[model samples]
Target: MSFAKAQDLLRLALMASTRHFGVSLEDIRAEFSVSHRTAQRMTDALELTFANVTKQTGSDRRSYWKVDDPTIAQLQPHQETAVEALEIASRRAKEEGRLRHAQALEDTRNGLMLRLSARDAKRAETDAEAVLEALGQVTRPGPRVPLNQKIADAVTEGLRGPFRLEIIYSGRSDQARTIEPYGLLLGPRSYLIAKQPDRGAELLNFRMDRIQSAKCLDEWFIPENGFSIENYAAQAFGAYHDPDQLKEVVWRFKPEAAERASEFRFHPKQTLQYQADGSLIVRFTAAGWLEMSWFLYEWGDAVEVIDPPELRDFVQGYQRADFPSLP
Candidate 1:
């Protein structure tokens, strides 16, 4: 067999061992960019080679093969890139104030390294250091709340179960409330996107830091039909979701800052129109004017809010001593 074919087989074997749901023939075909016949042959090869390879049918009635024995998939010398990526990610998470998450990543990296030879482990360390130095992180200085591991785990359970959470929130009110968890919006400051059934079907952002405790109830919830956390999060500038204030926002950048502004992914659905005068007009429909205002202040005189007079007023109002709150 060719060296490349051997490597592919090894990689496929490793993947099969790690994935709980196992791998499908379609998965093999997609992973290696092979034809259906080739994918079938690969599976046959795995069955012939690995004694512990077993096939199981899922709820969808589709059969997939899983390598029950994990030792069959050993770490190889060529997997330095994985180690480097993990190190970089760990450092970034630590810098971002996710200490617990960073430690978990570091632990995983260390465990993976231990599986390799001492020489390979040393080489991986050197390569990771080089990669980190070459690609340094530049983070915005802000309040990055470190999540409580217990609360985070509870929230995860609730989200995965589609279960209601009884949380002790310290934001605005010092009381416990039961909410149907939609999902979590992770960032410098994370939030739990959920709905208070007593209040209405409207979604609310509960700051993660303010959640003193979270208890996943035994009961499960019926998620709203056609509800997607990503789609909901995209409708806002940031975590603060206010459906009432949703508007078509427009901003114009001066000729000098146009190039800089063009490089920014301010919003997923944003569009840019470059003018003859070299100015750039950015347009996106979103909510969370407060968060948007915070970003706009950094641009100073280089940017102008052309649409949504309310937002323009809100931005200008900040300059006044008697500035009123957002409407």
Candidate 2:
């Protein structure tokens, strides 16, 4: 009835036309943040407006709505901003050593270009490249460990299959191992989160650089029940994780640095308490004290360790060059 409603109906039509399996009532409700009744009304509106609209039942026994033609989903010639954004993201991904992600982004950009006429596609690409070149290279501070492209590709294929990975690791010993990949952790040093069935189901981090080679096995595996990469990663402040060394960490930031410190997300589960005197206290439960200490050094005298006497002792000892024994 309203302009906004008209726009929403058109947007819904575009989405329904573009998806291969069509969309369900649940999908409509979630996308539009509408109730079941509203979603049904919107679906009815789409059927009335689009001649190609059809309904089909899914394997789950739920009905799905699809449009036979995707004319409504076609991109506008003036909207080259989308292409430019994808180009920028691809370069950023490459700079971050995420070769797979960069390739995917580039592929998507080329696909979008193919949707246009040959001449228009060439013009769009030339313009996008010009914009990218003018922006110059982005230099990211900190060390970035280069990932082995072949090993990275193998890890990706293994995870997609939920298959086992046979890898040659150059850790303390150069040994061949078969592991189940859970996910990957990308940082200054990238790692593959996997578990060796022979060793047990406990997930461990294996440095990507140390993986001399990887191969995806034909065997499939059921992912661990209730296993979340985010939750596992949250257990540690950085890519490093040591379950046995887990502890509640506390840090107090001086007023001079409190504002800047509050802007940082030191940990996923970290909490902040603003002191009456303007100091800030950050607290979180995590392992990897060594990684945490590395970040603390950046704050210099602006921060102090409030608990975990061992961590305080370690930091203090490291600063004084005594290298105290850590528990």
| TM-scores of all predicted structures | 0.73, 0.76
lDDT for model 1, please.
0.85
Candidate 2 lDDT (Cα, whole model)?
A: 0.86
Every candidate's lDDT: 0.85, 0.86
lDDT of 1 by residue, 124-197 (tens): 88887887778856656787777887898888889889899999998688688999998878898898889999
Segments of candidate 2 deviating more than 4 angstroms: 1-13, 19-69, 75-77, 118-123, 134-138, 317-327
State the lDDT of candidate 2 residue by residue for 1-327, as single tens digits. 898998888778877888999999999999999999999999899899888999999999988999888777774434367789998998888977888899999899888887788788778878877887789775666788989899999999999999999999986777889999999998878989999999987888999998998999998999899899988888898887887768899999888778888998888889999999999999998888888898777666678898788789878744322323211
- Between which residue pairs do clashes occur in model 1? none
Error of 1 at 281 (Å): 1.5
Residue 320 in candidate 1, Cα distance off native in Å: 15
By summed lDDT, which 10 consecutive residues of candidate 1 come out lowest?
318-327
Clashes of 1: 0
Q: Positional deviation of 144 in candidate 1, in angstroms?
A: 1.9
